[model samples]
Target: MSFQAYIDNIKAKTGKTPADFKKLAEKKGFIVKGELNPKTKATEVTNWLKEEFELGHGHAMAIYATFKGKTS
Candidate 1:
């Protein structure tokens, strides 16, 4: 799937947009000051999403990539 398609599917499944995930990640300390903390590991964030959001690995990675300002 395309990046946008993956993003749209995630939102449809979770009812949370990319912006919403950023806010949630901030509250969870994955992000700080509107940016992903440099020390944060992808596994940590992906594990959280897998546990809390029940997202698959790929989907969780998509969100993580989004945090890194990726669009592809």
Candidate 2:
């Protein structure tokens, strides 16, 4: 899916807009760097996405990739 599509999907799943998710991620220490930092493990981010947003793996990873600019 497209990056925007993934973001839209996240919003649909969590009832949170992209901006809301960005804030939540920041609170979790996932800095919004231009790219997915090598130090920022996907598993950690995934856990937060699941616990806080109740997102599935595919959806969580899609959100993560959107934040990391890895999706297109």
Candidate 3:
């Protein structure tokens, strides 16, 4: 799925928008330097998403892809 599509799916699943997710990630220290770089490492992102958001692997991966700009 495209990045937008993944984000849309996340919204559907969590009832939160991409912007809201971004803010939550920021609060969790997942976002840094004003961007979520593709090279940030999946494990880190996955852990944060799982721990803070209680998202499953699929959903976390979708969030990762969106951050990496790889989904599209």
In lDDT terms, which candidate is top?
A: 1
Candidate 3 pairs with clashing backbones = none
* Candidate 3, lDDT over the whole model: 0.72
lDDT of each: 0.92, 0.73, 0.72
**Candidate 2 residues 1-72, lDDT tens each?**
766777777777678875576677776668645344567898998898888778888888877776776546
Residue range 1-72, candidate 1, lDDT tens digits: 888988998999999988899999999899999999999999999999899889999899999999999976
Model 3 lDDT tens row, 1-72: 665776777788779875676677677566776478545688998887788778888778877766655545
Worst 10 residues of 1 by lDDT: 1-10
Supply the global lDDT for candidate 1.
Answer: 0.92
> In candidate 2, which residue pairs get closer than 3 Å at backbone N, Cα or C atoms, i.e. clash?
none
Better of 2 and 3 by lDDT: 2
Taking all chains together, the TM-score of candidate 1 against the true structure is 0.94
- Clashing residue pairs found in predicted model 1: none
Model 3 poorest ten-residue lDDT run? 63-72
In order of TM-score, best first, we have 1, 2, 3
